[model samples]
Target chain A: MPAIDLSTTPLRELNQSLHALAEGNNETEWEVLNPDGRHAVAVGIDAPVSVDIRGPVGYYCGGMNKQATVTVHGSAGPGVAENMMSGKVVIKGDVSQYAGATGRGGMLVVEGNAASRCGISMKGIDIVVKGSIGHMSAFMAQTGNLVVLGDAGDALGDSIYEARLFVRGNVQSLGADCVEKEMRDEHLELLEDLLQRSGITGVKPSEFRRYGSARKLYNFNIDNADAY
Target chain B: MCGIVGLFLKNEALEPQLGALTSAMLATMCERGPDSAGFAVYGQSLDGEAKITLQSSSPEIDFPALAKALENEIAGAVKLTQRATHAVLTCRRDELDTIRAAVRRLAPSVRVMGVGEAIEIYKEVGYPTAVSERFELKGMKGTHAIGHTRMATESAVTTLGAHPFSTGPDQCLVHNGSLSNHNNLRRSLAHDGIQLETQNDSEVAAAYLTWRMKQGLDLGQALEKSLDDLDGFFTFVVGTKNGFGVLRDPIACKPAVLAETDDYVAFGSEYRALVGLPGIDTAKVWEPEPATVYFWER
Candidate 1:
């Protein structure tokens, strides 16, 4: 493990130094000190490394990551791990829009609430938000699993695709293609696994309900044209 | 400092007369970014073809000679057909920057201004309405568009220091907050070979997005890529020929709302600004998530 001190060095130099370290060295974990909401703190890393951002970030904290695990001790701005291809990004605080959006692979775990379009158009990524989510949480989500441990706001999955959604609390309303689904054995098992993976404990597994695509709107039927 | 409007027709067939719609929306936002106004409307049938509006500081220079030089030297096939206090030209999409550079060289004393999309960027030291009228902005149209009214806190407020600054042809940005580390980020973007047009902090954001977009990323992906890299407490709106997108700062200081129906979608600095548009469902008008990106493709 190594250290990148952002306190005295300009954030650009500090980030560059860290990126260089990740690129040139073999250290698997790096500790950052005095990180104050800088953008692209640890972006475009291809190695298996863990970066602990000690403070908040402005936006796109660990974007386009592959085989890297970045953790933010504070809040994050919009687009954390956006378009990520592989690995894991864990934000301890709240995250802004399109968190893990269009992600082809990997997992994003947000311990706090997520803003609108949390997992928008996600492809093959699994997102577990421990708190509530805002409007259009998963708009046009083509694939992946969005597991929310709390409530969801308006348009949970409007114009959705094959993505599966599981919510533990009340849903304000379902979007265009999203609907309530039965919480069966497989769903409970999936919920338990996601909760455990997200490090969430103490809540009963049966307390949550499952919601996903109705599959009727997958092909855009003329009869369902009026639905939108 | 500036305003931008863009129209992308979904049908890509009718060449939707978006002039009136774009003009109307841009007019409403004159107060948001009064320095300049411009619009970029792409042809309906063309995959990425575009129509652009430009303004220059030096009106006396001959634009045709510069266009010729661009064609001969830079391989930019451009032609100047109209000349005014603010010059207008119909140019090849790939030749935009080259034509702009030629204008700068040909007329060193004058300012070479707004290019790409239907954006008619204007800049001055005054109100938005006067500039809107000066640009004759009420007549333009498109399918979907966005505009900005700016109050500059950092950077010069010149024509180059306007809102809805173009990162690429169709990707334009208008920001309401400041970037905390714009200088460093600007240097990084410049290091990546992306040009910086303005000293405004918002341009740093615009350049970041544009640079990412040029790397073969979609509009949404590019925006997401910029989030962690761009610092500050800001809310920004971007209108591209392909779609409309908005993002708020982490703390969510500035206010924004997303209102959508099957027919239309709108986001504004204030809900009242969108009051004039059709189909207002009070129930559907919702505040945007902080540090979140809301993108809709047309």
Candidate 2:
């Protein structure tokens, strides 16, 4: 176990150390102290290590992560876990805008509420928010599942694609080409798995309503060939 | 990009540390806006006393004579505290306009930064820390303060282009985004008899709020109306005599974080600016929503 205090050591040093880890490095568990809302903490890590950040972080924490788990004891600023691949990230407190945005693969969980564009243009990632999400969430998302246990703000899943949205509470309004769809048993199982992974309880998967693209914006037809 | 930081104190005990706290907060945001910085401090007001903050390109020549001329013309006791290139002239409250006119007459090169009973504005085309240090902001005492660091997106890098733009007495605003409709809005505001000192877009926003307030709207109402009238991305932190407010445009591309406790309310473009505050670890921190207004008054 290793501990890095960001207030004393430069943030780049901590991130560089994390990036320099060799295969099967003995120092697998790391603790970050006094993050103090700085930007780009623990970013671009490819090791299978667990980094526990003890305080709030600024922009783009845990960005482009791979094969690691990063947990923030406090809230995260914008772009937390952005472009993460094959890793787990958890924010125990509220997150700023674009949390887990454009993630290629990985599971990100926000125990607290998220600001707008929580998963804008997300690709092949799964995000579970224990609380509500803000407007324009999952906008034009090409892949992944976004589960919001609490209410969603205006324009939820606007112009979305392929991504599955499950909200137990109200949806202010759907985005263009985004409409409510039937929740099949497969969707229920998927939602259940995401909830269990996020350690969510006291909420049933059956309580959610699903939303997805209407297949009108991008889909083409022979009759409309001339329009292109 | 630009940075805006504001602190409104609820407890009197924390007032003495207001400037130091705000300066630290502003310094943390230097990366967001490195070209210039400005801040407005709302100090404790006395009976019928107002101050006008003035800045000049050549303070050595403009400030001393201007202070003496103002003292004689106003026929009242005048105190001029000089910083690097700025000065605060404390005088009789009713004579604010008279002194403003006198200073313009006495020193043609001097620019009145802001005028109010409690507000003292200082802005410069420099880094945030040096600007704060030159003004001795760490030693100043105030009840609340709003600060801005500018990156010079839509305007040139000059003292006037720096933020914490003042348009009305005891009112100031710091903005973090650009306005697309400023040229059009500036014309409309000018047509309505509102004068602006700078071609900076943020000043137009300040004038708009001043115009709204003149129409009998409070700070909160004025900010709400701005959501519809002002076009473009912005996260504005506004300061009045007794209160400070925060408003973000509906598109909300700009970021704003707010933290509140029993002692004070704080606003930062990002949470990083607030880490140095006392008891901040336990403060209730959250990002302000888009198209919303959050204000605090002592």
Candidate 3:
């Protein structure tokens, strides 16, 4: 295990050293100390390593990650795990806006609340938030599963496409072309697996409400001109 | 992007450190908005007296004769405390309007930053640390203060365009996001006899609140009205003589974090600004809900 003190080592050098490591190397475990709310830490890693950041990080931590596991002990700034392809990113504390934005694959878990646009344009990633999320959490989401154990803010899934949303608590409002749909057994089974994968317990899948696109705005229609 | 920070002290012991704490918070936000910065402090107030904060490009020439000329014009005693490029003019409450008019007539180049019994504003076109140092903000004492770092999206990077815009007496507003309908609202507000100072969209927001307050609406009511009437993405932190308010638009595209403890209520564009405050780790931290008004008054 390698321990890097961010107070003495620049973030760029640490990231560069992490990026230079070969896959499946013995030096796979790393620790980042004294993050101090700096942006873009542990970004663009393509290795199967594990990095634990001791303190709060600024924007875009673990962005575009592949096969790496990054965890933050403190809160995260905006865009945590943004555009991640394949890996696991975890925030022990709260996260700011656009968490897991545009992620294609991998799992992002937030122990605390996630701010606005938590999974905006998410393309096949899975995000599970133990706390509430802010407005427009999954705007224009093409595919993925966004599970919120707590309440959601306004416009939960506006302009969404194909993505699935599960909220155990109240939703402030639904977004354009996004609406609550009936949760059948298959959806419940899917949510159950997601809840298990995210290590969420004590709540059954039956308690969650599913939201997705209405499909009315999927194609151009003359009657939909007024809504547009 | 722009950054906004506010500190409202509930404990009297922390009053002396208001400016220092707020300066630290503002410094953390320099990356969000590096163009310019401004701040307004609410200090001790005197009965029957008003404090007018003024800024001059040529402080050596305009500020020296300002206090004496304004005292003569208003027929009252005036005291001037000059910083690098700003000054606070204290005069009789009844003579505030007359003194402001006299200063405008005496020196058109001088801009009035704010006017109130307890508020003094200092701002300039520089980095947050530089502006705070120029005004000696760390040494000031106050009950509450609000600061802004501007990114200059809608307007030029002039001193006048700097934030903490004060259009009404003792009332100033700092906003993070741009308003879409500000030009139309500015015209309507101007038609309603509200005098606007700059083309900056944020000044219109301040004037709008002032106009609402003048119409017998309290701060909370004015903020509620703003949710319905004001169109745009905004997270506004407003300062009054005795009140500090935070409001965000319905969409809440802009970010705002709030933390409150037994000693103080603090607001920042991000949590990092609040991390350095005393007892922040134990404070009740949360994100402000959209279309909601949170205010604290002494």
Candidate 4:
């Protein structure tokens, strides 16, 4: 394990060192101290490594990550794990807007609440939020799964596409082309598996409701002009 | 992008440190907004006296002569204290409108930054640290303050385009994002008799709040109405005579974090701006929700 103190080490150097590590190297465990809410920490890493950040971080933490496990002990700013390719990024505390936005793959978990636009435009990632998610989460998402245990803010899944959404708590409103769908045995089994993989418990998979695109605007028929 | 920091003190004992603490917070956000900076400080107000902050491109020639001219016109004692590019003119409370009119006539270049019993605004087109130092913000004493550092997106980079745009008596606003409908809204607000100062969209937001408050809405109500009337991405921190309010647009693309302790309530564009506050590690930190109004008043 290697320890880098961000209070003294420049963010560029720390990220460089993280990127230098080879895949499956023995020194795969790293620790970041005194993050101090700096932006772009541990970004663009493509190794199978673990990074434990001791404090809060600013925007774009673990952005574009692949096969790297990054965990922030404190809260995170906006765009955490944005466009992540693979691996996992975990926030022990709350997160700001657009957490896990446009992520293509891998898992992003927020132990606390996520602000507006959480998982916006997510493309194939698996996002699990233990707490509430803010307005417009999963908006225009092309593909992925977003699971929330707590309540959701206004206009959840607005104009969504191809993404699977499950929420156990109340949704303030639903967006265009998004509607509640029947939770069949397959969806229940998938939700149960996702919950188990994300280490979520106490909430039954049967308690969740599924939402996705209604597909009415997939090709834009003339009848949909009034809704537009 | 722009950075905004606000401090509202619940304990009078911390009044002396408000400017220093707010300056530190503003400095941390210099990277987010490097074009221009400004701040509004709320100090102790005196009965029957008003403080009018004014800015002039030619401070040396205009500041001295304007104070004497204002004194003669209002028939009262006028005190003018000059910072680098700004000056605070203290006069009888009732004489503010007359003094303002006189300034418009006497020195047309002198811009009225703010007029109130307690609020004094200082702004410039420079780095936040330099602007704060030029105004001696670190040594000032106040109960609450709001500051902004801007990266120009909506308008040209000028001293007049800075944040902390004050539109009414003791009312000021700092915005982070550009409004899509400000041009139309500005015309409507101007039609309603709210004097607008700049083409900047944020000035329209300040004037809109002023117009709403003039119509007998409280600060919270004005902010609530803003969600419906104002369009575009915005995270606004507003300062009043005794209240501080924060509002985010419905989309909430911009970032805003809030931290509150028993002694103070603080707002920052990001969590990094708040890392230097006293008891911040123990403070209750949260992100302001979209289309919601949060205000604290004495």
Best by DockQ: 2
| CA lDDT scores, all candidates in order | 0.69, 0.92, 0.92, 0.92
lDDT of 4 at B163: 88
Worst 10 residues of 2 chain B by lDDT: B58-67
* C-alpha positional error of residue B78 in candidate 4 after TM-score superposition, expressed in Å: 2.1
For candidate 1, write residues A75-132 as lDDT tens digits. Answer: 6766889988988899997787678988888889999888778888888788999999
lDDT tens string, model 3, B132-152? 998999998999999999899
Ranking 1 against 4 by TM-score, winner: 4
- Candidate 4 docking class: medium
Deviation in angstroms for B28 in model 1? 4.7
Q: Candidate 2, B257: how far from true, in Å? A: 0.8
**Candidate 1: where is the Cα deviation over 4 Å?**
A1-228, B1-52, B59-85, B93-101, B109-125, B281-283
Expressed as tens digits, the lDDT of each residue in B1-298 for candidate 1 is: 2333333344433234454555555555565566554433332323333344455565556656655765676664554544344555656666666666665676666554445545444444446555555655555445565556656679766666766677676567777778899999989888998878677898889888888878888778877877789888777777666577788776565645455655566665543344444554332555576667778886
**Can you tell me which runs of candidate 4 are displaced by over 4 Å?**
A220-228, B72-76
* Deviation (Å) of A194 in candidate 1: 37
- B156-215 in candidate 2: lDDT tens per residue? 899998989999999999998889999999999999999888889999999999999999
lDDT of 2 by residue, A1-228 (tens): 899999899999999999999998999899999999999999999999999999999999999999999999999999999999879999999999999999999999999999999999999999999899999999989999999999999898888879999999999999999999999999999988999988898889999999999988867778888987
Worst 10 residues of 1 chain B by lDDT: B41-50
* Ranked candidates (lDDT, high to low): 4, 2, 3, 1
lDDT of 2 at A47: 95
- Say which prediction, candidate 2 or candidate 3, comes out ahead on TM-score: 2
- Model 3 lDDT tens row, A1-228: 899998899999999998998866899899999887788999999999999999888889999999999999988988999999999999999999999999999999999999889999999999999999988889999999999999998888999999999999999999999999999999999999988988888989999999999998777899868975
Model 3: CA > 4 A from native = A179-185, A220-228, B59-62
Ranking by DockQ: 2, 4, 3, 1
